[model samples]
Target: MTRSWRPWIAGATGLALVAGAGVIWSVRGSDPGSGCERTTITIAASLDHAPVLQTIADGWLRTDPRVDGRCPDIRIVAARSADVAANLGDARAAGGSAAPSISPTAPLSPSESAAAAASAVSDASRRPTVWAPDSRAWAGLAGTRPEAASLLAPGAPSVALTPIVMATTPDRAGALEGRITWPDVLRQIATGRAPLVLGTTDPTASTAALLTLMSLADTDGDGKPTAAEIAGPLALERTARVYAGSVDVLAAQMSPGDSAGSAPGARVSLFPATEQEVLRLSASGDAPPLVPLYPAEGVAPADHPYYVLNAGWVSARQRAVATAFLDVVLGTAGRTAYAAAGFRDRDGTLAGLTSASGALDAAYRGRPLPGTAALTEVLVRWRALRRPANVIAAVDTSGSMTEKVPGLPISKLAAFRQAGIQAVRLFNDRSRLGLWEFSSDLSGSRDYRVVVPVRTMADQVGPVSQRETIIAATNRLRPHSATGLYDTIDAAYRAVQGIWRADQQNILVVMTDGRNEDEDGFGLDELLGRLRAAKNPAKPVTVLAIAYGSGADVQALQRVTEVTGGRTFVSRDPADIGAVLLSAMVNR
Candidate 1:
């Protein structure tokens, strides 16, 4: 949209207001009255490069006001690449819903028709005119749909490049330097013999995490993988080992001291992150400087792409302005600023700050990203193939849960039972699962009663397998007595810890409603103390608590999860318990 604008001079000094130390020189000579109007272009870009892009945009505005009647007023918004991709996908899905059905009996006037067309343009323009995502995978994802495809301009050029890497202390990097490949990292973790503690960001959230999975899946020399390769048992096992919850969790565990190397006490010894992230962390001095180790195989670099949208909201003039904005980003000054912020040039070559930026070696090259279909396949495969969980499910049989769910005829307990069965199906034969129904007086003096003991699903009974037994027992669960939330949580945590295996993602999945009602059991203070005392760094067991219905004590649940490394999932509507349980079951 074009807007009447005043002359706004953003000097190079504005660049310093952002992250990283970059010397940005502004382009001058344009007066405020030089251009009649300006087209405001909003670019939703990855968090890493948004500030630098703004700097470039500022320079472009000063250097050249209007290329063809429309001056550009670029506004850069920070967003995750995956989020932007998801938004585009959602917009495409909703494209047709906004159209009003016109009856033939009443034709609109010309003015009304113009208003309707403008309204349509406004709806389309609600989305960003330009999207500069971290990797080309997102662009590949957006191209699959007609609505999203219409928004994309051809030939999106890479503005900057940063390879995903495994960063650790110098000692760990030295140890694994020449010997390490993508599979080896997973193998080391599976064997519980990794030279350093391995971790990665959440695949669902971070493109780097998914790429890390892709690298492991790329068994052959070629970056592309066949369905057969991804479905193989070994590949799945490796991917499971590589995922260590989320990046925030990993970052929290990192040692803040410079002297802290790959010691036993150090939370994370090795993590997969962008090179720029590693530099940022090191620069902050809150953590020790990490030494990046490139894998023996190829790497997937986040080649930030500038895509000028071809949507109805973006006029021909706006398109030209976006192209001009891209040119400025690819120009010499833009390259220098990116180099200062620890990014490689568009050609995948190292920037001027070789030593300061910990530049990648010349041999390191960018690998081709998987196609849209294959990438989608790999992500779906990852969910199923992830580390088999050792879960002790505490299904609350509290009296409150007996009440019927809103709008649905089924009771809360009934919904949970069905959901339990559905969630159990997500785990495979490799997983160890168990069921426990908790409420006061259910198991004679205890607040919790173990219905099905935790055991490997592969174990054989007299006739049926252990997995079938758990499913059958879960379906038979019934609501009974008062909620013994705190005591049951303590018992489950202790029980899961007893059988904790370093390789497995040991967890206590507590599905409950209402606060601790066991006056006879230990109070919240005592339970919290006990849980804190039960903490074990080497063998971690996260508590995934699901607070079901309005009566569910969310505050109490959060307190319980704080002691453990797990999180609480709330489903206020009992109708959504099934979906919520399914999501909570996934490791991500």
Candidate 2:
């Protein structure tokens, strides 16, 4: 319920400067070293609190803030929470004790998002001494790895507060007043009743997205996710497009110029965002306003936790300065800065932006932060059970595929080969995959050859991952012999059944450029009977067939997939194969 968000202007001159200037430049104020040694201390503040943090730090530094009589250069950096997490997560996994070399901080990649702070901020090659993410959700996520529990100093107090809310167009907010929830929204998406495309940031990087990801995964309220819970999202939400670090830019992306599916000038989207985000962006008056929608089931609130790094790179002097910095945040100076920015104080006290919460501004109360042990428990469960997919694809390698797609530069097989490589990237490491290439007499009398054995993407095939193995095999494909479609699909169906796990989504997809060419091959009627007969009511194998180019039999492929409770897709133009393949991959 509480996660402070992107792009709400607070009262500080620094906040206004950043919001208007499209930058977060490092400031080395007039010589802090009148007669003392000079040192630079960088504070990696989450985008939600960067401006306020900078303002407060500047005020505290004016008092000649120092460590061991060393005058310090207070540098406040606006780092997206997700970018910092990946860097810190990597360091924790590597067990690196040394501090990262102090490289000059990089600006946000996109010129505009520097204000939105939409790009990843931390360079993967470096580390910082302090991290102030907008929520304990980050702390919980980072702490999932065992060493991270001890690697980051704990109990950093909250400096500001915000609640997560479902933001929608002003017109829709009334009808959905109290009935919406994460489960309800996700069910609509999976069931295809969802009215608009949902927007989200990468869960690993954004606290708001992490909270939403865990919520979307925990439909049964078990506090842990199952593959069944993950399957729908894995298939349906696949096209939602995970942005690098911007909830502020989500609705804007709804315009056709930014992403797919939406009609031109159709600027509208739905997402779980912070109250301050809805308020701040609405206050801007340039774009159409978004109304806040509270879920029937509660949301987790975000508290801006100020963290001082516990790695070897944090010297005692840096730690001392960090402690002093923490003191200012916990004191009146920080509270005043946050209040002016339309954020709640640590105690849930609000000021300056009541109307900024948009339509549902009445009596908004932030939920309490969970204790450390409970936070750790939830994150552990999440880490153990992120969504996993089980998909096996059968690619047609018949000689007819060698014919060039009409009006296209590549052959039917070449287009699909490239599509196969792109599709493999849609699945995470937890998912299992396998591949087969089919044509007549590929191996002895068999119509198909098992090119890459079905295995989890995490597995190493000699020196590369199973995913790489699948890609390499696809790259090496050459159309040969006649299409042996029917029998090969049946073989892959049986393969999925043999390895089917009750917890995972079990699917088998067949890609072909032409109809069965083998005279000895089983007829379509015979193949459909075998598939229907082999079907397990409990462990179903969904079969999807894609017909590439106009030469392939669409009706036959449809009949084939229909028997196994799946549908077929057509890419009559090889140019459309990528979109069609993606549609096939995530189609339920």
Candidate 3:
């Protein structure tokens, strides 16, 4: 994702409040009796809950007498939660001198209205007057601030608290005693003892999904589940049953007798929950009842909190309005709304709701919460467990790559040179990185040069310093060698096999801009056989192929990636080469 920031210039000479030597700039104004006038408040919310928040905003504006005559038009600007904080930062920065002050945003999207309120507290200059998130944890993350205050006390009044329940069919729950544990679930799926159905939203895009994974890691007695934990023998064997996407999408896939035309027995039976809220929303009077299973292990609550930024340009009247809105949201009425949404009351009590009986064992309540540090460690460890990757960065020193494109005087070869410099820098730091160049037979063949051997280095070095060395080497190549694409990949693979790391994740990232025509004995079939044989019983190596320019073979490169379990990207613009390579590395 590209990082974006908006720049705004502020107007000159606003009243400055210098209380206790702290600079506070306020734009003086009054609530002019312009009642019922349409105004817009831009809201950045998670996509999953944007629909619900929109519903509430429309309902509140139409039905509430207090808001009927006084409410301003609310305009929501929805985006991923991860993008909210950065976008808010841009908006705040843009309001400098030439623009009006506004509210601050959070790094993560809010899970509940209370969390949105808390995040608003940090927006001293650009305080959002209203906020509605999906969970209470957002409130905790948002905390209290000097310019903004918590609308709800910590655990005082909850907008909603839902239990993380397991969604399985009545039949599947029968053999498992209705109660389930992470180990039991994994065992059943691994051994093929039970037809298990597991679904999770993309953790990258959803905070609630990530929390569920964290809860599972905690239940496993493993603080964090590494990629290896997820891709291990057990997980790999269960891959046929795993689904990653939105909750609604998973629900549709699990609906019984609802499969359009797949196998007769294909049905999803397990799901994560937010307690009563999900159950009520998922209920259909005509469909099979969606049952809930509380895992024997303790559950983790989604604590969404609101945050606000305090700057020097907030107007006093706006501040008062924001404060009023905050108070109203944390009051009894807001907490009641929270409970109605299937959230636990602020006290962490389940209220009068009974446990799912046999669905969860009493002994499971004491399981410890998963730590963030532990999860990070697991990711790192899993990365280490992956077979070491083998990469050959094939460059084009052909006359075309050396020609300059319009606007930019820099030749395509120069761009490739710079990308090579970057690739080397990345390879030097991680895995086994190497370099190769191909052109016409006039320049003859160049063997792979070991730029950074994975086994030789202990502490990885950053690539900035090595730019001059790579540039100097690249500049020496004449644009006359044959573009022996197959030969080079064959050479690189052979080189990779010679220096094998049994447990490492073997990979090849090939960068080329032309077709393959060579004299080397390596054919497509032989190369593939070598690639497959390298992994044996375990799937190890991966090849990420990048084809630049119109002459590149997109299909052949895609086939290579498919066979190797890697990805392929075709870049029409050479400038994008560096970024594409970087993405492949991070993902690897």
Ranking by TM-score: 1, 2, 3
Model 3 score (lDDT): 0.46
Model 3 RMSD vs true structure: 18.2
TM-score of each: 0.57, 0.54, 0.47
Name the top lDDT candidate: 1
Off by over 4 Å in 2: 1-33, 66-68, 89-127, 144-149, 175-178, 186-194, 220-222, 231-245, 253-266, 351-353, 356-588
Question: TM-score winner among the candidates?
Answer: 1
Candidate 1 regions with alpha-carbon error over 4 angstroms:
1-35, 89-95, 98-126, 223-249, 256-266, 357-359, 386-588
Single out the weakest 10-residue window by summed lDDT for candidate 3.
15-24
Candidate 3, residues 1-588, lDDT tens digits: the string is 011123212111211111111111121111335344323333334443444334444444444323223444443434444323212222323443322122222212234212322222232333333333444333323332212222323333233445566665565566463446655666676566665655655433345544555554444555655322332322322333544445556666665533222445545566565555345545543334566666666566544343322333433443444444335445555455554454455445654334333332222232343554553442332333222455545555555666664467787777666665544443322345445665645333453344433342223245533334444565665565556666666666556556556645566667777766565645677767766665443445566788877777888788777776779888877767666655455456
Q: Single out the weakest 10-residue window by summed lDDT for candidate 1.
A: 9-18
Per-residue lDDT tens digits for candidate 1, residues 152-250, read 666788999888887777655654534767677666655655555566665544777767767766667475654335423243343343345345456
- The model with the greater TM-score, 1 or 3, is 1
lDDT of each: 0.68, 0.65, 0.46
- What's the C-alpha lDDT at position 551 in model 2? 86
Candidate 2 per-residue lDDT, tens place, 265-342, comes to 434466778777777767766445777776656556678888887765567887787787788887888888887776
Q: TM-score of model 3 relative to the true fold?
A: 0.47
Error of 3 at 294 (Å): 1.6
